[model samples]
Target: MILVTGGAGYIGTHVVRSLIRHGMDVVVYDRRPLPQPLLDGKPFLPVPFVVADLADRQALDETFEKYEFEAVIHLAGDIVVSESVAEPEKYYLNNVGGGMSLLAAMRRYGVMKIVFSSTAALFGLPERVPILEDDPVRPINPYGRTKWMFEQMLDDYDRAYGLKFVSLRYFNASGADSSGLIGEAHDPETHLIPLVLEVPLQKRPYVSIFGTDYDTPDGTAIRDYIHVSDLAEAHVLAVKYLRDASESRCYNLGNGRGHSVREVIATAEEVVGASIRTVETPRRPGDAERLIAGNERIINELSWKPNYNDLNVIVESAWRWHKGQN
Candidate 1:
């Protein structure tokens, strides 16, 4: 059985469904209880859920004791990059400190395999386009620093104990399930595709484009936006890789294609059949210029491939889900 911390979250929901579709037993542990609206009639409904923060040692111990977990997909962490800068203590205490609590419990219960949800922010400003897994990491924000710090802990744990891990550095996780049963639904959605979709949904006045003077063709930052389902599939493959007793590894998951902010808005406009307004703004701290992914490593190793790599297709999926929400 697999234990998914934060399994009720945006990405966590998809990952849990993927694990179920792959014929693995899953139990979710999150700081918040599972939202009933998310699973009232979904195909992968009724997954065992444990509601508690990762820092709660009692909750972790009880969960570890109850479930005979083979591996863990650790996704329960503070994710807002901008918020992390203003209140770094929250990021450290939750992302880093919470992770320590989870790791200690995993060690105690002999569940040493974990698939960590990492981010591309660790590569603050890459020296080249299509960043590689081995690229230098100099995180400029507290959130990225927290992820980097947690990854360092994984490496140290691997050396000290017999813990094996697969850290997946996702570029930009967007889109939703075609069924519209689940999708990206962050409280204050910070992702570009969803934020742009909001203009059409009448939720926001205009899409804010940060970093308009970038070196990219569109003069806006370019990011590799891999579909959410594609990212979910990688987690299943990573757990399988570790299950095979393979060595600890880290891989970058992306579409291998870069889309500028203008391209994203254009795609959303076409998908929603409505012209979305936009405003140019300064770059947010810790944002990279061009963050296309060189995902050959995961491709060759896990035989992982992205089914929805096109910008139009990616935005269309999100449009379907968001339209359903309204």
Candidate 2:
């Protein structure tokens, strides 16, 4: 059976759905209570949901004791970059401290494999465009620093013990399930697509454009936004690769296609049939100028082909999800 930490959140929930679709026994451990969509009555409900925090070692030990989990996809970590900057200690506690606790639990049990959800922030201020996996790790924020620290921990664990793992450093994860059953729903969403879509839905007053004078074509930041479904599919493959006893690997999950902030807003307007009010603001601290992932490794190694590569397709999927929520 596969255990998913933080599987109740936007990305983890989709991972659970994809794992179930692939006929894998799955259980979700999330600090937050499972939303109504993942509840038993929903048609698109995935696997069993268990509300547990990885930060609590006792709870994690109990969970490991109860399930004969062969592999675990660790996604339960504090992710808000702004929040992390405000409270670096919190990120360390949750991302680093909680990660250590989970690793200890896995050691206590015989669980040998893990697929971690890492971020592109680990490669802050890329030395070159299309950042590679081996790029020097220099994170500009606490959130990215925490992820990098865990990667190092994974290496340590691998050397001392025989804990094999895969760390998928994702660029920018957007979009939602094609079926619109589950989607991004954060208390204060920071992702671009959803924030723009929310403007048309009147959920937010306007979308903020941070740094409108970058060296890009549109004078704005360029990012590689991989669809959520595609990311989930990669996780499934990562789990399978581990189950096959493959060596520990790292893959960058992205479309290899870059989209500017202006282009994203324009596409969102077209998809939602309404213009998004915009406001210019000073560049967000620690925000990179441009980030486009070098997905050749994942493409060649994992054979990951993103179906929703087009910007319009990405925006349309997210638009459907936002409208459904209304």
Candidate 3:
């Protein structure tokens, strides 16, 4: 059986569904309660769930004891970059501290395989476009720093112990399940695609465009957005790769293409068939001009291909899900 930490979250929930679809017995371990709407569907309703934070060592140990997790997909961690900057301690305790507790439990339980949900923010102000895994690890904020720290710990754990892991440093993880059963739903949504979709949904009056003076084609920051399902497929593939191979690996997951902020808003408008009001604002602190992923390594190594590589497809999927949420 596979255990997915934070499986109730946006990306983790999609991964859980993909794992179940691939004929794997999956259990979700999350601090947040699983929404009933998520389980109101077909394949996901019967899946098991454990509600506990990763910081609680006793809870983690008890969970490991209760269920024999063959492999773990670690996704439970604080993700808001601004929040991380405001509360560095929260990031450290939850991301780094929680990761250590998980590792300890994994070591005690003898579960050697894990797939981590890392981020591209670890590259910080990238010296080059299409950031590679071997690039310098200079994270600009606490969020990226914590992810990088956990990745470094993973390296140490692999070397000292026999823990084999794959750290998938993902670019912008957007979109939702194609079926629209489960989608991105944060208390305060920060992702670009969903935030733009909210304008069409009438949830928000206008979308805030941060930093419209970046050195890009449209003078807006450029990013690589990958579909959530594609990311889930990559996770499954990483798990298979770990089961087949012995060495630890790291790969950057993305569409290998760049889309400016203006382009994304244009695409969202096209998909939603509505004008999304936008207001220009000063660049948020630690905002990079551009950050695209070098996905060739994962493509060649894992034989993974993204189906929803087009920007329109990504926004369309997100729009459908967002509209459903209304």
Model 2 global lDDT (CA atoms, 0 to 1)? 0.88
- Per-residue lDDT of 296 in model 3: 91
Model 1, residue 131: C-alpha shift (Å) = 1.0
lDDT of each: 0.90, 0.88, 0.90
Q: Going through the candidates in order, what is the number of backbone clashes in each?
A: 0, 0, 0
Q: For candidate 3, lDDT tens digit of each residue in 44-68?
A: 5357898999988888888899899
Cα shift from native, residue 91, model 3 (Å)? 0.7
* All candidates: CA RMSD (Å): 1.5, 1.5, 1.4
How well does candidate 3 match the true structure in TM-score terms?
Answer: 0.97
Model 1: number of backbone collisions: 0
- List where candidate 3 sits over 4 angstroms from the true fold: 38-45
Give a tens-digit lDDT track for model 1, residues 1-326.
Answer: 99999998999988987898898899999978765554445544458899999989998999999989999999998888889888999999999999999999999999999999999888988898688999899899999999999999999999999799999999899988777778888876888888999888999999888888887787998889999999999999999999876589989989888988999998888888889999888987667788988899999999998998888988999988899889
